[model samples]
Target: MLKGKLKLPDRLGNLVVDFEDRDDKIGGSSSVLASSEELEIILPNGLGFSRHKDDGDGLCCTEEKKTNEAAIFRASARPYKDRAGSVSAMAFIAADEKRSDFEYQSELKKNTEEELSSSKQNVDGDSDGLLRRHEISSEDHPLSLGKASVWNQYFQHMDIIEQIDRDLKRTHPEMEFFSGDTSFSRKNREAMKNILLLFAKLNPAIRYVQGMHEVLAPIYYVFCTDIDEKNVANAEADSFSCFVKLLSDSVDHFCQQLDNSSGGILSTLSRMSELLKANDEELWRHLELTSRVKAQYYAFRWITLFLTQEFNLQSVLRIWDSLLSNPFGIQEMLLRVCCAMLLCMRSKLLSGDFAANLKLLQNYPDVNIEQLLHVANDLSPDVSSYCPPL
Candidate 1:
């Protein structure tokens, strides 16, 4: 396993690897390490991996030649002096601290009534995160989900998006871009209404949810290539129908959340809660004991709307640029944001515990978004003695 990992690059993410090893000097003498290599990743079924050559374009300049489902990575075995363990270790430590900070912020929610009352406005503001003020409606921001004409218009946007997606993959091998056929161009409000009806027919479990439109906002931006692009002529009918099918499939993540045990919006927020508890037992206990568990409700909308409903639309766009471009890191980024928000209300949160803590947390959003961003970006590791293997 060491030899195999040594053959790859010094950084990896979202991949799993298997290896058989018995090394007393390393983690243990276990015959098999389910995950032993820190910098190695196993490719998922659809991913295509390639190596960079000194004279080559590094897989970004051209489309992948091999479409195979499985492959191993290798590179020149350079001297150990070239290792970037410090930098990689920093990322791992940052991730761990992020987990701890999330717990700390949650615990801080417990405080006295006086502090909670004064901090109430902040909590409401933070509950929404930074929301975009721009509103999309049938008249101005019309999206025709299922109509033939709307589908055609939507295709024009998809073409632009698909081209960009392919280009990005070639240019940035580390990033992933998703594009599926979905239409947004509607000829009329009636067509748009029919599209929604169709969406319901396809998935009866998901009646329309308010924030879903915002969830699909990226597709609109990507498809149209610009927010300024107005409605265009609808395309061929056959192409439009195919595109609608894809659109339905593409938006499933948001849709799935709608049907989640908790409302769809809350489910993603809960995903963070579940992950934190599974990964950090001590911090979880601290939060429960402190009576700060209600922070989850305050943090819910930030995840559901992708922070679209909380701040200026322009700033929200920048946040989305980070969130969509790096889905893997966004969850951690969110936890950091939660911590930063709590820090802004530290006076209130620190005043007391238990019932007081819940009251304090109720008024969370009073902190400034800019301050939250700074804390999130500069967050340090939580310094726990029981640091687990990454």
Candidate 2:
């Protein structure tokens, strides 16, 4: 057993790890070298694939006729790489950190104390290596169901995620951009499916998670909606390139090991609560301190899925405009947007009890998308001087 602390690198998060399993040089066998792709991802997710089916990547882009306009449009639009630092600042702060605006410091301190009392490990221990033996094959050892399930889930994660992506890609069928009972719509879905699959294949660390297609939808839509026909035809290639750039910073959210770290979704939720307290102290106290509502109860999906599930497609598209354009970074801007969401419902959240407030946030009421963006932009007025019109 390898006992020392082994620090693994993260490519796409350092997904692929090459390990020397053994030093035996029998017949110069290169097969002894184990890599991230030790096992093939073969779980069927409604989308059929024969054992011999080609990866479908080459056919996706080559089938379209190459055009000079396509190349030009690709260069002009989707400035994600150039505008890399797009989010607003102050993203993931620990519960007790100092803030600019007036906040409920005492109550926040109490909450942090309560969290530690639960024996929850903080950022330092978030990515602890697996300690327990994965397999116990002895005839005398009865199988532990818990360990078995964990083993299976860890190994089969890619397949399960592929199945999930298959289902989520069918979202909003009524929309003209991605669905319909026509050749055009089918072609669009195919292109999107290809992009999603390509992304998964490229980033083995985070193959595909549910609601990711939602992240891709607006990007694909914007590309398809391009006026030039060649650019429209070349949407898949352009979207694929831009999508990779778009998710580069936010990929940590997809890594389960980092879930509790400063980069994970929980840390983000903490930052969201902190942002709320900094802006609207009473409302923040009412929900977290008085009502004892955890940010994860409602904000989990919002923060993790980029608010795609909480709002409709059009509203989501509008929200992404602000998120992608912010100068801070997606994570920081996301916390601000989440805080703004709570602020928008200030009157309701304040008067309501735990049950009432929980219901309201879980089943979030219809919101003014433009106004929500406005509130997010208004947060931390001291740091940012220019709030772009949404």
Candidate 3:
């Protein structure tokens, strides 16, 4: 059900299973193929049987279904759950953020012992073993690989954005429309342009710029993949155009001319600092004198785009998975991530005076990507609290 001018990886053209080296077998030898709603994974001889059940660990391939000549692998639930088979599918993309596919695939596969003993549970540990899993988990999300799946999710997000816009428009018809039909290419473009124009119109405080691409990339990918999956006939170009509109809308925030003071994330940080100062005075003073200024250099992108640039694509997708599902009131998961990062750097900050702390945090890449992700996951008191309402 993919649309126009689609390109899959060359190796993915025809799936091949390499079992020549191993003696294990799946479905009593012969040839076994597994089909999910999304893809078909073929198994050659020698790959052992994998169950399609959630045995506390993760989704597994369960049983092989038969039809006269050949057998197809289908997911199965073990003892308790009704749609046990569905758990396999659910592992890939669960509406429940805490138990979703992204959360299951951790990064520290081989180096489990090396992983920080922090309370945070990272989806992907920094192991070579989990890298592929991390990639697989977020392959469906836009932020991971920036494929069509991202476009699909974007459509859902846009639906909400438009829903909000329409509600606002009824009260004020002069308000610009933010939604567009996935099928109408030209209209989608026009609609998006109007939307961007409206964003500029609405937030005269920010002007259009090129760097907004980073934010729009994830949105567009989410929209495209979501649309393709839902409506099968939606044009890829149309989804892309809509994404462009989104970028156009946020252009003002990234304009180099805009300083930290006006409407951008710097403003958000200022507000956050004020909130912290009032709420956690000691932490605020420590951060201001030490990590805060350096945080400005490193934390700007994190705050502005929600760590989209800081971590790799897979990590970003999973992070957003938690972020989009957050129910907490702060409304910004990125802020929490910033808080987590500062916490991770606490030892360095505590060791030095304000200047040393600034020097250390700014120059040192002490917090690896995997550690940061773990901290991000753990920092949120409630994992469910990090995800914004869908």
Candidate 4:
């Protein structure tokens, strides 16, 4: 017989108890544990119980069995301390007549609690006393609780959350809204974090990435810096909606699964290369042959991050205006813009070798925005031309 005082911890409100029998050896003789005997527990009135089957390994309590032969009974208890610092016991007991195991186990838990209470009372009657009984239903249990805040659903993605926080802190360090320890900066960082979190939560596949904070910074900043002071306070909410809208069109590029589809990043790169070949065949061939610079090598970051990584804050914002305004969609216009960026540097790229050209494309030089957009608008893909692989 195992006998010892078991004090339940405060945090064990969702505790699950498992009962199993093992062979016992007395005086070098083995004896099998009998299933005929029933264990009894005397618990307080408020406690509740339910019968469930052991799913596997007899360790975890699974869903309640339908046949009513209770293979296992589990009791959940919530312990609370009163004003006088006296701890009260509340437990749940599972009862079913169809199964001897369930009936015996239910009785066992009830009797055990009652015996423990009696023993405690004998030791110190007035010191620690049981409080008024409040019934514990299945619905009241924490495990059976309803859905919490929508944000709570993403608790498993805490790593994503940490990454977002780190990225938010590092993004646009020069800007006061995202940089320092001021309340405004903290608010902006939080706004950015919330938007990214919601985006990941909604789209489980593409979820959050490192560079996304950069993409969202401008949107949130613009909303916060609105002319109307009232709009400033609601910047985060407005930014979230706008960011979702913006991401809807461009999210495909970020999805790795879609990278090789007809409309994936490869397709976009092909389109850009085709546009380049049509507009400036000499420049395209020179980069592809002599310079050995492929579109994916340089254009992957440019296209996926919405060119946010290639340019300064002011220039990116200007480019985004055109991107967001284009009814034909940003993908086509982005290809044109990328081509224009290359063409704008045609003079330098023509003279440079593979290394120099690759560096130039990776770290793009400044150009006249008005002229670049004009050149981009003028250029269009020759659909008839076969776009050979780079």
Q: Count the clashes in each prediction.
A: 25, 7, 43, 19
Best by TM-score: 4
Put the candidates in TM-score order, highest first. 4, 2, 3, 1
lDDT per residue for candidate 3 within 1-390, as digits (tens), equals 211111222322111112211214443443332333322333434244433446785443343412210222212212223322323323433456655544555544534645643212343554433333234455575565343466554554465455434432232122122233344433433433344444443553553332333444345445544644653335344544554453442343465465564555556566555544544467667767644454466566656555655554456666666665655432355566666666666666666776676655445453465576566555524332233433
Please write out the lDDT profile of model 2 over residues 246-315, one tens digit for every residue: 7776687788888898678777677777777778888877888899999989888887778877887878
Per-residue lDDT, model 3, residue 72, is 23
Which candidate, 3 or 4, would have the higher lDDT against the true structure? 4
lDDT of each: 0.45, 0.67, 0.46, 0.71
Answer with 1 or 3, whichever has the higher lDDT.
Answer: 3
TM-score of each: 0.34, 0.55, 0.36, 0.59
The Cα error of candidate 3 at residue 198, in Å, is: 11
| lDDT for position 292 in model 1 | 58
RMSD of every prediction: 44.2, 42.7, 39.6, 28.4
Q: Candidate 1 — worst ten consecutive residues by lDDT sum? A: 13-22
lDDT of 4 by residue, 1-390 (tens): 211112224323213121112222133223322454222332344433443336664422333332221222223234433223423233222223346687788999999999998977865666456554678665555455344433334454688899999888888777776888999789778878888988898887888977988888888888888999989888888999988887776688888899898767888788788889888999999988877889899999888888887887888899988876765466777777889999899999999998898898898888889899888878865566434222
Residue 231 displacement in candidate 3 (angstroms): 5.8
